[model samples]
Target: DARVTQTPRHKVTEMGQEVTMRCQPILGHNTVFWYRQTMMQGLELLAYFRNRAPLDDSGMPKDRFSAEMPDATLATLKIQPSEPRDSAVYFCASGTRGNTEAFFGQGTRLTVV
Candidate 1:
């Protein structure tokens, strides 16, 4: 059994700084998703990729945020000039089509001053 893996599980940054989070989705999972969790918004899907191709990213703020699957084993999410509002736990999940369960990473907790 394999599981999604995330790096830098906890992060603290100053406002206007840059932040990057990384994840490794489960092998054989074609669909990968990024999510942001907050008290107000709960869990919001930011972006997703299928077979290493980005399907949609409208949920993310294009001005400062970007998500990409650089290769089959690596996915990255970055935020430049990060703001306090951007502070939240970002999660990575992966699942294949026809699979009802989503495998999720431990989640990267980001804090911006």
Candidate 2:
């Protein structure tokens, strides 16, 4: 079945630690997105990619957070020196280039203590 698969479904880390999350998008999908969900912000789009090229990442903190699509099927999001404020559910989604319907992964819940 075609699905978006995310790894490390839950994570707990101390402040100043590094966190890495991975996602495998469904085959044939050309667009991918990284999102962070918080009670206050709701679902915020952190990064966007089409055909494995990053089109926007302005919502992400450039100093500490990064999103990349290393290959056609692999996407990654990393946070360095994570702070408690970064705690949230990170989601990976994929869809076709011209489609509005996106398939979301289960998400990776992160807690920085």
Candidate 3:
């Protein structure tokens, strides 16, 4: 009964708008990841947090993207001044240490015009 869930599965936005995406990770999972999938990126790891603390976010665009875990089951990624180049599928995944199987949400497909 536990699974990752994402909101606003599809979004259409104009350039320079603020976009918010939400994720609910599976229960009891300690690691959460944010990824962007596109023709150019091919499922790039954008950011991740372990035990509610961010481990790495080097793949995320610092100026426009931010990711955070406000609680055990919730994670969020926000983009400000979203550009056409940012249009892609954003996914959230969760897993435990040394666990290769990650549970992924359906993803939020953003189309920036």
RMSD of candidates 1 onward, in order: 0.9, 0.7, 0.9
Where does candidate 2 have its weakest 10-residue lDDT segment?
93-102
lDDT over C-alpha atoms for residue 24 of model 3: 92
lDDT for model 1: 0.94
lDDT of candidate 3 over 17-74, digit per residue (tens):
9999999998889999999999976999999899989999999989999998989878
Candidate 2 C-alpha lDDT tens digits along 1-113? 88899999999999999999999999999999999999999999999999999999999999999988889989999999899999999999999977989999999999999
Task: Give the clash total for candidate 3.
Answer: 0
- Candidate 2 Cα errors over 4 Å, as ranges: none
Question: Which candidate leads in TM-score?
Answer: 2
Per-residue lDDT over 42-85 for candidate 1, one digit per residue giving the tens place of the 0 to 100 score: 99999989899999999999999999999999999999989999
Q: What is the Å distance of residue 106 in model 1 from its true position?
A: 0.7
Model 2 lDDT, full chain set: 0.96
Question: lDDT, candidate 2, residue 15?
Answer: 99
The residue ranges of model 1 lying beyond 4 angstroms of the native Cα positions read none
Assess candidate 3 and give its TM-score to the true structure: 0.96
User: What is candidate 2's TM-score against the reference?
Assistant: 0.97
Once fitted onto the true fold, the runs of candidate 3 whose alpha carbons sit more than 4 angstroms away are none
Flag clash pairs in model 3: none
